[model samples]
Target: MPPSADPSVSVTLAEIARIAGVGRAAVSNWRRRHDSFPAPVGGTDTSPQFALSQVEEWLRRQGKLDEVGGRERLWPEFEALGDRDAMGMAIAVTGARLGTAEAGHAGHAAGLLSETAPARLGTADAAVGIPVGISLSDAQRALVERAVSLARKQGAYETFDFLLGRWLDTHVRQIGVTPPPLADLMAEVAELSRDGEAGDVGTVLDPACGTGGLLLAAARRWAGSGSARTPLKILGQDIDPTQAALAAMRILLAGHLPERGDASWEVDVQAGNTLRADPHPGIRADVVLCNPPFNERDWGYEELATDTRWTYGLPPRTESELAWIQHALSRLSPGGTAVLLLPPGVASRRAGRRIRAALLRAGVLRAVVALPPGAAPPHSVALHLWVLRAPSGDGTELGRPVLLIDAADVRTEPSGGTQKTGRAAIDWPLLRKIVVSAVQTGGNGGNLPVGHVSVPLIELLDDEVDLTPARHVPKTTISTDLSLRRSWTRFGTLLHELRDLTATLSALELSTEEPAGQGTVTVGDLVRAGALTLRAGQQPADGAVRTGDAPTDSVPVLTVSDVLAGCGPSSWLPAYEVSAGEAAGTLTVTVPEEVVVVGAYRAFGAWVDTDAPTVLGPQLFVLRVDPTLLDPWFLAGCLRAPANARRAGTHTSTSSRIDVRRLQVLQVSLEEQRRYGETFRQLTAFERSLREAGAVGRELVDGLTNGLSAGRLPRDRR
Candidate 1:
């Protein structure tokens, strides 16, 4: 073991693969083929853990350590600490050191080594506001030094941001991050509401800040509006102490960014439950932006029933989001704006109706924008943004109108010839433009966007007082004549395609008599003989898979749903290919031509993928067959046969899952295999054509019914 190695630290196989910049399969292969491989120290046989010291020594001797990045090398050590809070503290310490060095405070480094270092580190400690009673170990201190060195090489801000992003990725389920697009949109909307203000934004607050994503976005917006030199004050509070500390470090570092100008910042972040304890009781900010936790029951409802913040009304126990809204309203100065991302239920839930009515009555609610799904956290639901303005304590604003805009249909079409999923990628740029325009124009009738409407406060103060934008926005009408003609044209094209497919299917010939019995082999046999290689798709870490349209750096992933449906990839994952002697951990296996992808659950099916370089998703099996030994299409067809499906299925009450190794395929000559493969391919095409025709047939019927009822088409049709 190396002198610095901690014998107590052990790493899982996945971590070892990440450390060596290889796949998990490669690590397993190493264990099987190499005699010098380290033995498992602990954990179950399926997921054995190896001592970090031994693994490090082995990698060093194998020359794999040469290409590993400094951050990747330190990650295992941090994970071995077995405490997320300590990992966060170590990150905070590293950020403090970087900030100190960047500001030319070399003397403070010595102070950090002393017993009173938290107090003597000066601005570094003041900036981060390190938590009390938490001290670093000797091993942790050494890790911090290495992190500081890395920051020096690759710009302090960049290195810190990378580390923070990775940390967020690891604990994605526990932390809810505001998606960048939504964050930017919220900032833009706030800016639009405050248009023509005399100077820069004075102060901004986020009660449930959650690492200060909203506040940071607000700062960027202010800087982009050419107010970079203006002084800004940011306040935040979170229940997690580590998050509060890290948020402080992020804001402090943002202030020093060269492109953001020399804006002096007064950042005050505290660790406590914001709803229970009001930290900034007396200060009113110019802007308040928040994306608070949803549906929380125990948000000090019992104890704080009479808390002065509930000016709108007493929020019910089930309406924690409403309480957050009122809390945001209380933090704003008169005429100041507060933009909050809230669940759609708060707009119309029975428990929140009273509070919603009170807000509309006060003329405080400015606009309600309905965003597309996948725009933010809880990506499956379409969330709403309530833009509220603290009334200036005047009766003149009592009868103001509220703008309602529904941009839920604003999304990008999937790219790279991939099939669409239930969720679509939000077109942030278009959404921003539609929303900003609607808010700026107050959604007046003239030339307003399709889903924009301006409703009077009196009109909205009905019995329910539902604030859902979709309910109020008028549905767009289609031209009867034009739609009828377009439907007819599409119907004709689909009929012609269907006819050709039917003719092709009819041309194929088959033998009437039963053929001689053929030899068969199991998939496991073929894999063992080197004629096929089976690879299981890995379940990506939470927040790692990108749904909808693929980004430039991402690749389409072939999911089990895609395999079962006989379609293309429905989602994407980041590509971590080795580039320029650097590896971004292990490279995900990209399916090549002739690869057979099989669905492992719900049903037994197979797809022969001709598209190369598609990443495989979880709950699927990729079978790469040797062309000399097996035909890919023939193998896929046999595996998908009903008899084989029944034999391989593991039956349960809900659904059937396939054991891919148990699937059987016929053994035949290559020429015979090619003949059957061609027929199978033709049948697949016919099935797709039938589905298309069915969809078009429905459209045709609907169009005819509407046209005849509306007198747009003559009933005689002579």
Candidate 2:
């Protein structure tokens, strides 16, 4: 295969592995085994690179083209284009074609020309109706055709989003990509707030729309709500010109195409700072959703000193988030809703306290929701979403209660400890439902749901006017009779469990003698001796049915979180399930005498004793031990020790990877190892008992306190 003229159009080994849907070791093996494999055309000796065109051709010849995705194949060509403006314009143009395809066949207007020659680089430029100052090669044209074909097969939305998501993922370190869950939640909040309004929401706006994520979410929500036929106008403004163009394209591609004569929806995307340059000064929108840049000091404060948007009060220099809030609020029509994602600090910051108080008095600040960290970008800190409505200036409306939702503890996992590498996984659908439901039922002076409460405006107008949801939301309330009944039942259950545990502990014969180590054997030695085998799990693909309960399918997939939490397989996605001959593919079939170890050092391992076959999720390591040679539970217990965890921590940085080969195992007979495993099991049971007892004890204290605080129980005289 002839190499491309440009050496810049090459990928790293890791990228190649991702594109090929295989392990990095597989790529290395291919390079060594095949003489026809593309030779290194660039990069250092430590990390050689191959020409993308040559590599792609070789993969096709090898019948591995099916392994590579369309987006994966097209990205190298996109990178090769090299002009940022042209690339943005090209993406937008492709998005338009996708939109046209989504709209149904519309002849030449939809770029439905014969496939005699693939659309060239200037093709999207023509579609965009502008000059992007770039030309396309024949290779680039073919790449575009492949992308369009893939989009057609995958459905336009999924394909477009996949490409956009990958692009964002690649540049996340340089420019923050708003986490999809957060963006969707913000849009849902805005949509919910528009409920029971005077008119339908036809105009949606996002002033600092980074890449039109918020607007796209809004459009999706509208489409899902039986309004697909309605034409909704979208407006976006951003500081970066390239980002602005991309945002315009995203909204255009995402819109519902007209079936008959022409498209009804109108899009206007401007490239300018919203605060410094008020591009759409006089236009008020029905809904505004924004995840503005936080802590931006140089936001042209001096130039906007006399701006009219600051109706309540001028935002301080340190409170740029407050400024974004005002800008969004100013853009909302009367009784219209706006949802803004901001740092938690903005809710209770001293500088913005007066403004918060003013907004509350005016009834513009409707709700403040505190989200858990890792819900959005800047995953290190928890953020807040402020729900606002343009004031109608009615005194009775100003007296209404404000809803506060404290979702700081709402996470897939408990937030007591630090995560090793990635942020905690989120249940986005559940989160959106919770927030929207809370907003709908809140502030009626009636009963609120758990994790939510309504505070009277009079109460919120205190000296501080602080809006921290956790501070204001009422604690889980229990009456005297109910509290006593619940506490007694819990105490009885705990006592019974304790009694059972004590009896079981008494039956175990745990040797008090110290363990004797005749020799040390590494896990690698056991593997070399054919005493054990190791393997890892595959990541579940898109559209997979993931569950938090018992699987409805034939197999149970164990996830890393399940292992970390010391539980059996509970959650499973549909992608791993096989039908007939599909079983011959990558889905793992678990056997008896297996130990599942969490890949991170923060957590350890579990010994599988289930009767049925199972599979493992991503980042979980499986050690299939020979029962006659080594006890599975014994190895798992050894791996779970703090000493071994610390040792593993030293071998890796940032994320501690388990090097099973380096793990030291005790040399002992299988029977002796079984005895040790029994002892370990007993200890684990005791630890669990202590945790349950502690939680039950806390409940008792809370019940007693709540009963007294509410004056529902008489105080005993001592």
Which candidate should be chosen as best, given lDDT against the real structure? 1
Q: Count steric clashes of candidate 2.
A: 1
What TM-score goes with each of the models?
0.76, 0.63
Best by TM-score: 1
Please list the residue runs of candidate 2 whose C-alpha ends up more than 4 Å from where it truly belongs after superposition: 1-69, 72-90, 96-146, 149-158, 173-188, 191-195, 220-231, 256-263, 372-374, 379-382, 393-401, 407-434, 451-454, 476-718
Q: Please provide, for model 1 over 379-436, each residue's C-alpha lDDT reduced to its tens digit, 9 standing for 90 to 100.
A: 6578899999888887655878889998877775544323323235666787887887
lDDT of 2 by residue, 570-666 (tens): 5443321332113444554466657766666655554544433556667676788888898877888787777766675546553667776777778
Error (Å) of candidate 2 at residue 5 is 9.8
RMSD of each: 7.1, 10.3
Supply candidate 1's per-residue lDDT for 242: 76
| Alpha-carbon shift of residue 473 in model 2 (angstroms) | 2.1
